[model samples]
Target: MEMENMIGLTDLLAAAIRAWKQICVTMLVFALLLGGYQGYRQYKLATDPENSPEKIEERYQAALEDYEKRGEELQKKLEGQEESLASKEEYREESLLIKIDPYNKYITNIVFSFSNIDESAQLFRYPNTAADYLPKKIRSQYLELWKSMDVPRDLADGRYADLEWKYLNELISIPALEGELLSIRTMGASAKDAEDLAGAIFAYFDGHRDAIGRSSAAHELSILNQSTKYVIDEELKTKQESLDKEIEDLKTGIEDTKQSIEDLTEPEREDGYSVTAIVKSVAKYVALGAAGGLFLACFLVCCWWIFADRAANSFQLERSVGAPFLGAMKPSCPPAERLAAAVMGERRWRDPEQASAYIREQAEAGFPKEGKVLLLSTLPEGKAGAGMAGLASALEGYAVTSVLDALHDPKAVKAIQDCAAAVFVEMAGQSRLTDIRDLAAQVEGAKRPVLGVIAI
Candidate 1:
């Protein structure tokens, strides 16, 4: 078995473009053949007595049932996920009262003395409207005021920014107002968090005490005591964390199911088949045939290009020498061009003047003075020399210093060391990729640039 050779993407791409019209033609031919075959088949199927309207209607009913069944399943799954999430959230809120730590580990309490009417004086007296009524009303008002307190809310946002309002509010424990003595407890992530929050609450009552006394029949406001307490129940934090993770996972599942529902969307419902339904069916099959043909044609073109021995295009020339491909210049044959259009498409056309000018400009630019641009070929030394001479004699201004078989001529290696750059002259259907590669390696080894290729 022979060793395999490496093929470049440049080779495959150029080959495809060079034969685009041929690929298109192949697809057209296959499309016509397959479409005609499908048309005949569809015509037979249309006339078949087996496919009565009743059968087609039955097919529609079955498809509709399947669609509806699938939709119902998705809706049920979505509802189930929603219900589960809501139930878990409700449980989570209920547990939040115990879940949010007040002082993180330690809690603080501050006490205040506020004056209110002594109800002991009315122990023996019947309920009186004057003293009894006003004091009772004042007590109720004070409770409401504490319920709507904003000190804790402000502290939650500022000093204890990590704690949510609900959490911070939960962390604090307040007693019902009854007499002169009032105590408020606060807790947080650190002892400082609790102390700061307690201070803020105390400051609110102190600053607003006179107003509170006037509004609620209270006398004095003072901090009587300050104490710290420890909180127990390590499991509350763990329980809350577990609940949060579960809720998040459920949400992700719900989103995935939504995507699944979208992907498995209900199929379209078809109406009854018509008298000309056979014609429509035939056309649809023909379109499918054309699409199939295009796919196969591309597949064949790719395969042919991969295994071909010759580096036929300018792109491959560029890849071989790792240099800029100036362009390919070859004399056009009318018969060959015509045959190519009928078969593949002739190699992509490039104007000869543009091709030659590109070579000259690049060759001149590579070396401004006293530098030869070596024109190398795969042919024998005599043949290569004669070919270049004939080109110079025929073309008005096209010139070559010399032509040498870079792989065979000993002088070619020396020239590569001497010349500024080189260009390969590849004869159509003759220059092997192996020969070009060998010559390219020699040039590259000598550190000389290969400008590009010229195809004769």
Candidate 2:
């Protein structure tokens, strides 16, 4: 097969462009439908209540009011607790209510000597380092502790205590502390757990305190001198007593300010999509849909054009029949004027330069010389006769004769024999190669090989 017959790159591209043009109306319809769908989606999103900016702000306002209401309730609770010296002891007793708290069972703990009990030696490092030094067995103890607390131990389920412990380990942070003080602390799944764990850790540390003390005393005496200790203890006791009322007032003030600030500030809904952003997204979708629709139409049309054995351009027609293609006839040209007038303009039926070239090439290909007759014949009928006549007029000294409907009529054979040689004229793009081959066979059977073909 010829390269063009096998679908060369240039031929495929031209067919694709032509196919796109042929199916342009369908492509436009698809594009319009896609664009309309995109527009509708955007309209729905813009009008939807959940996405509406007004509804979002209303929800935010409602949430703010609810938060304020909660803060007000907390304030009432704080106010109900009296701060008098008589009530001070009672408040301290109530603060220890974690003892009865059911959630305390989930507690876990670690205690470190925050102060340098041995004045000659460094004590605990940073809290992070301390946390890192915690035994792996202790870290994993949350599971056993949670199981003992009568919580679910179905570890496969995410809501169970074991699952909670797994995630909580990642979220838990070892808080930093300042200054030097002997502090026992605890933390766990809940605040009540933390409080209970702090007490447990204290008990645990106290149990080992004598052992720790003996070890520290080996380096240096941990206990201060009696006189100095007495003076420091008394001074600290007096200072604490003096500041108790002020500390209570500051605590109340801090709580009130924090609650008020939380109620007054509006939290931003960062997850919400803006109208401008949604519109831009919709526009992008619409553009992509339109482009995709157009490409799909082109691709479908191109596939059909390629598979169907039809000529898309002059080159394909030439290569398909392995013939010299003279020229092409524009589709817009009216077939009435033999399609020659469109290329020749107002000049009646003839193109001088084109006709001269056609005649010269025919003469070079062994067309009989001056004063001989050259018969013009065409397949199917006289559709190309006018163009043939025009070319014949430019045949220098040879006189041209034509047989209309020559391929289908047997009487036309006599006319071919009367002439020096026969030339076949074909309408480009409209005529098929098989029909031309059949016409050539008829001429060859009649003992006159066709000189050449002129495509117009």
Candidate 3:
């Protein structure tokens, strides 16, 4: 068998050399694609510096420094104006309250004093003049007595007037005297002038004490109004401008960095090959070429192997099966008749009684007695016509004739004409038997009686 012929290294090498065109094309395409892809990747890395590790680290460091610098500047600005900022904010709130309810008389004189009471409820009322007129101990006792009383409006006028005079005289005197002194000082008055001024102030207070208190409150409100507007507005504007400038500077820095990165990037090519386009093109050609080369190589090798094996076996069969072994007149007998005769005859020749019995049975059945030729043949197991001739020759008193004209030498047909009976063997299977049958029919139509078939 062709399979028994071992393939050597030399044969494999020869086959590869024979297929070198396809292999070289495939390998060259692959190598070029790989090298081109690597080169393009390197080009991309070289061009896009923003994508580079060194540039990225540098940008990160720059951003960190800028952030720290901005933070420090903001901290310094905040530290420099901390007290002023708080004062301006407080003044703005006080000014707004005074503007909203200026004539509500208790507003300005309501001083908040710290005590052991809960700080959340510290907004308690006190006599407006208590800080000025009475001695500290006496004022404490008076406030305690006032708190204990429950004076209602329907009380007798005399009784109410008595309490009111006591409270007013004790609390209002010192504050009114302080105001008179301030007026006297402002007028640059001598003793005579002070005394005269004191009389007039006292007379004015005596006539309209509540009106004087209201006027004093209005004066304090005017002072707060004059100062708060300029200070609060200017401070807020300055801080806001500083913050806006800082934000604008940070944005400019970011934009500048982004522009630098864009400048460092490679510009798009108009006509030159792009890395992505080159890689895709190379891959496409490589895949197409490799596939075509592999398929062609496989197909050619398979065809050569099949044809070579078939030719070799046909040659061997033609050489082994000899000619003119069957009887001459009837050159076409089916090979099975010959093989049955061979097996039966071999069995009978080994035992004469069986052979005689078989022959006697055929004779009794009125089989043809004109020729003693027993065509012995069989379907070939491996070679095309070898088994037919081998089996026929193995039978006693049988001349074997094997023909190989279908796919081998056709000269055996003339030798088959001289045989008394011809046996035809068809190899392979049913599909292959058509040609064998055609040949058999031609031979059997001649004067010779053809025998039965043998199949394997």
Worst 10 residues of 1 by lDDT: 340-349
Native-vs-model 1 lDDT? Answer: 0.63
Clashing pairs in 2: none
What candidate 2 gets wrong by more than 4 Å, as runs, is 1-4, 18-20, 54-286, 311-355, 369-389, 402-420
lDDT of 3 by residue, 291-370 (tens): 66566675565455343332122112222232211211112335543343343221123343443444334333432444
Candidate 1 structure quality by residue, lDDT tens digits, 187-261:
655677677777777676566656655654555555678987667646657766788899999899899889878
All candidates in order of TM-score, best leading: 2, 1, 3
Predicted model with the maximum TM-score = 2
Query: How accurate locally, in lDDT, is each candidate?
Result: 0.63, 0.49, 0.38
15-119, model 2: which lDDT tens digit per residue? 444444445666566666776787677778667778767788888888888777877776665565434433554433432222222322232333233232343
C-alpha positional error of residue 253 in candidate 3 after TM-score superposition, expressed in Å: 42
Q: Whole-model lDDT, candidate 3?
A: 0.38
C-alpha RMSD of each candidate structure in angstroms: 15.4, 21.3, 25.8
| Cα TM-score per model | 0.40, 0.41, 0.21
Lowest-lDDT window of 10 residues in candidate 2?
223-232
